[model samples]
Target: MTIFLGGRSRADTGNVISMDRFRSGRSVSPIRQAEAYWSALRRHGDVPNRSDIDPRGLENILEYTFILERIAPGVARFRLAGNHLSRIVGMEVRGMPMTALFSAMARAEAAATLEHIFLAPAIAELSLISGTNSRAVSQVEARAILLPLKNDLGEISRALGVLVADGPLGAGGLRFDIAGSNLRKLDIRPDRSPAEPVPGLAEDQAPIRRNAPGLRVVSRED
Candidate 1:
């Protein structure tokens, strides 16, 4: 497997890997498959709704798939997660904050990156490294992607993601550090309508005042 690590300018053409390479291989990368699935759902540059997702579409990569719900600024908790994530954390990870998988030093950045995904409503690709301590038994590298999703209420507070790690996962829970990241802002067409109407009640029409300027208020019973 080709591990892409280190600093590469986002503008560099080499930073982008073609999906064709995986097509030529026996097994395609789960990350690429997840991305392709998400991209296919987009219509006219609009973000896909969470309801539109179907597990059958991601059958091959479901083990690496997850769904996140934004709870607060820069914070998100896993709404649904797969076995691969549980294996890394050594526990059921559903309902846990997504930052739980990151080392203390990396959590802040991870949270910030997550916030950007929902706020900018962008797509993010991240590179991660774990088990790099001197006493660690093995080093594991990973690639993950975050694709924004709209909830039933039409709020952009949900996300669909996939994380795929390469290398032997050492015993115990693993915490990864952010190695690199890239963001692609969603291209929302100007003509696209708002996901939902303005919150609260609709505007009320003001009562008209008579031209006499001395209108008196009277109860109907009177």
Candidate 2:
């Protein structure tokens, strides 16, 4: 597997501090709201377990939601997917590599991001576009979210995800063409250390709080 390095220790090899492709914006869709709801469940620095997810709680966004299970280092497969996800591919998406939904060109990066999410226990958000091809002529644009989840054993090898298409989808089988992606590493460590003070700020001066929660990858096509 390809390895990415960050400034921290080997123990943190599973994590990254940040990346350049991140952007901050308003949360406009039901999918984004779902992510916020998931965030609200984290109490006492615990990564929410798959068992903790209640399908009814996501009824509004349920069609866009999904769950993934890590099968190997840096690899995850769909354990369950929503109707909206199945409709995009014109078939059930369970048991497939999460990359199956991505365009050929974007699959590698998508896989890498999944790895980052699992190993680093990060939250990943992506802006995606689907290719125009036979059976599906019109292109589709969408957004996707992947958040880390713990398994029954408490290992951070599961993910909770959601995909929301911005426009009407073509009837033909469709796949994603990644446009941009952002990753935010969560500090779910049990200790939950306080953030260090920024330089040049007075001890009494409150540090400017930026809502940035992640790193990112801007697609060349964008």
Candidate 3:
């Protein structure tokens, strides 16, 4: 990924991994990808019925963050420019809303993408920074799509979005850590809730003793 933010400056960034990963139904944290596929199926102003959604597609749309809580219309939070994020802007956001993930300037950009997924209206892309506080800023890429959910009466209900980030995906694997290596991960909840799970492990395997539905465990590729 290459980003030319203010015009004169350009930066090399992460890849938008192929949509092939969307086919992995057994995989965890594929919510975003699944949502995109749903939106695609109902391309003519039509929304895919959740039942009509392929198992693989369905798996890709559930964010580990939301799955663990089993909450709909929830929020995912993160630091916009922490060492882990390694952006020009540096800040800590342990429990901030996912909306805090971008700057005001970037919000419109980010929102446009999210709305497509949340509102089931569009597709968007992003080039973000990694390394929360490490001073090592690496560019990452994100591609997302949104799909709409309809109720029994055909009223639109929920919106599903698929998100892909390519690059130094994580800043660490443990929860509530201040500084660490960046890797691909799902933080499990927007509140940084006391119920938060260990970063890289499945709820079933994580050392913590939680009896929730068991959120998926996503592994970072070596």
Q: Pick by lDDT: which candidate is best?
A: 1
Better of 1 and 3 by TM-score: 1
lDDT of each: 0.78, 0.74, 0.36
* Candidate 1 lDDT trough over 10 residues, lowest sum: 19-28
Per-residue lDDT tens digits of candidate 3, residues 46-109? 6555446444544423332121010134333331112332221234443444455444444444
lDDT by residue for model 2 (1-222), tens? 223322234355333323222233322365577788788778786788889899888888888889999898657888998898888888888998888887776677787888899887788877676776525656666778888888888898999998876555667478876666567788766865788888888468567656545755669996
TM-scores of the candidates are 0.74, 0.71, 0.36
Report the candidate with higher lDDT, 1 versus 3.
1
- Identify the runs in model 3 with alpha carbons over 4 angstroms from their true place: 1-36, 39-45, 50-97, 112-120, 125-137, 151-153, 170-222
Top TM-score prediction, candidate number: 1
Better of 1 and 2 by lDDT: 1
TM-score of 1: 0.74
Cα displacement (Å) at residue 37, model 3: 3.9
Tens digit of per-residue lDDT, candidate 1, span 51-126: 9999999998899999999999989999999898888777899999999888887788788888889987788888
